[model samples]
Target: MRKILTLVIIATLTLGYSSLNAQNYKFGHINSQELLNAMPDKDSAEAKIKKYAESLQEQIEQLQVEFNKKYQDYLQKRNTFTDAIREMKEKELSDMQQRAQEYQQVAEQDYQRFQAETMKPVIDKADAAIKKVAKENGFTYIFDTSSGVLLYFSDKSIDITPLVKKELGIKE
Candidate 1:
C-alpha cells in the first residue's frame, strides 16, 4: 500500500509539471524605431523635411539679404543726412531687422507644426500595421525593444522587427 501511494504521488507531481510546461506562451519583440527606419516611406518623409527646411532657409536668406541691403544704404546716407533724416533711417533699419526676425521665427514654427501633423498619420499607420502583424502571427504579446521599457524577456521571444517592417510594406 505504501509503494502504491508513493507511485501515485510521483505520477501526480510529474503530470502537474508537464501540464504547466505545455501552457507556454509565444511572444514577440520588435524595435519600433528599426521598423520605422525600414519603412518605405521613411526616405520620402526625410526628403520632405529636408525640402521644407531648405525652403525656410532660403526665405530667411532672402530676408537677410534684403535687410543687409537696407542697412548698408542707411549707413551710406547717415553721414550726409541731417539729424532728423538719420534718425528716420536708423528707425527704418531697426524695424526691418525686427520684421526679418519675426518672419524667420514664424517660418520655423510653421515647419515644426507641419512635421508634427504629417508624421502623426504615418506613425498611426505603422502602429496599426504592428498590431495586425502581431494578431496574424498569434503572438501573445509584443514588446517594443527600442523603447528600453521591457525589464525582462526570455530568448524564446521572437524578434519580430523584420516581420513588422515587412508588414509595413518595406521592401528592403
Candidate 2:
C-alpha cells in the first residue's frame, strides 16, 4: 500500500509540473512615437494647428499695435486733456489690455482642445491596429518603447511595429 501511494503522489506531481510548463506567453514592443510620426494624417493635423496658431498670433499682434498707438497718443496729448478724459482714456487702455490677456488665455485653451480633437482619429486608428496585430499574432503583452520608461527589454521581445503598420495599411 505504501509503495502504491508513493507512486501516485510522484505521478501527480509530474503531471502538475508538465501542465505548468505547457503554458506560453509572448511579448512584443513598438515605438509608438515613430508610428505616430509616420502617419500622414498627423502631418496634416499639425499643419492645420500651425495655421490656427499663426492666426491667433496675428490677431494678438494687432491688439498690441492698437494698444501701443493709444498709449503714445495719450502720452502726447495728456497735457491738453481734462481730468475726466484722462481717466477715461486710461480706463480704455486698461480694458483693452485686460481683454487681450483674456483672449490669449482662451486661445491657448482652444488650441489645446483643437489639437486633441484633430488627433483623436489618428490615435484611435493606431490603437486599433496595434490591438488587432496583438490579437492576430497571439501577443500577451505589447509595450511602447517611445516614452523612455521601459528600462530593459531583451532582444527576445518581438518588434511589432511593422505588423501594426501593415494592419493600419501604412506604407514603409
Candidate 3:
C-alpha cells in the first residue's frame, strides 16, 4: 500500500511538470492583410488584374453598342422587308445577342482565372516569409489577427508583422 501511494505521487508530479513545460510555448500574431498590402508584388498583381478587367469591360461595351445599332437599324427597316426576310434578320440579331452574352460570361471566368494565377505567387511568397520569420523567432504558433477570428489574445503575445516584413525585405 505504501509503494502504490509513492507511484501515484510520482505520476502526479510528472503530469504537473509536463503541464508547466507546455505553458512555455511562444505564441505570436500578425496582421496578414497589412503584410500582403505592403508587398510590392501585390501592387503589380492588382494593377494587372485591374487592366485585364478594364479590357473585358471595353469589349462588353463595344458589343452592347453594336447590338444597339443593329437593333435600331432593324426597327427602321422592318416595314420594308418581306415576312421571311424579317424573320431571318430577327434570328441573326438573336444569335448575335446570344454570342455577346456567352462572350461576357467567358470573359468573366477568364478574369477570375487570371487574377488567381497572378496572386498565387505573391501569396506564396508572403506565406513563406511569415513561416521563415516564425521559425527563426522561435514562435510555436502564429495567428493571423487580420482574419478577425481571434477573439482575444494577451498583449504578452508577440506581434511578428515587422519581423516577417523584414524577412521579405519590405520596408515600413
Could you tell which candidate, 1 or 3, scores higher by TM-score? 3
Give lDDT tens digits, candidate 3, residues 1-172.
Answer: 9999999999999999999988989999999999999999999999999999999999999999999999999999999999999999999999999999999999999999999999999999999998998898889999999998999999979999999889899988
How do the residues 73-150 of candidate 2 rate in per-residue lDDT, one tens digit apiece?
Answer: 999999999999999999999999999999889989998998899889989989999999999999999999998999
Would you estimate the TM-scores of all the predictions? 0.75, 0.85, 0.89
Candidate 1 C-alpha lDDT tens digits along 43-159: 778788889999999999999999899888887877999999899888888898999999988998999987877677678888998898888998888888888889888898998
Q: How many backbone clashes does candidate 1 have?
A: 0
Provide backbone clash counts, one per model: 0, 0, 0
What's the C-alpha lDDT at position 158 in model 2?
98
Runs in model 2 with CA error above 4 Å?
1-23
Ranking by lDDT: 3, 2, 1
In candidate 1, which residue ranges exceed 4 Å CA deviation? 1-26, 148-152
Report the C-alpha displacement of residue 37, candidate 2, in angstroms: 0.7
- The per-residue C-alpha lDDT of model 2 at residue 125 equals 87
Model 3: residues with Cα > 4 Å off, grouped in runs? 1-11
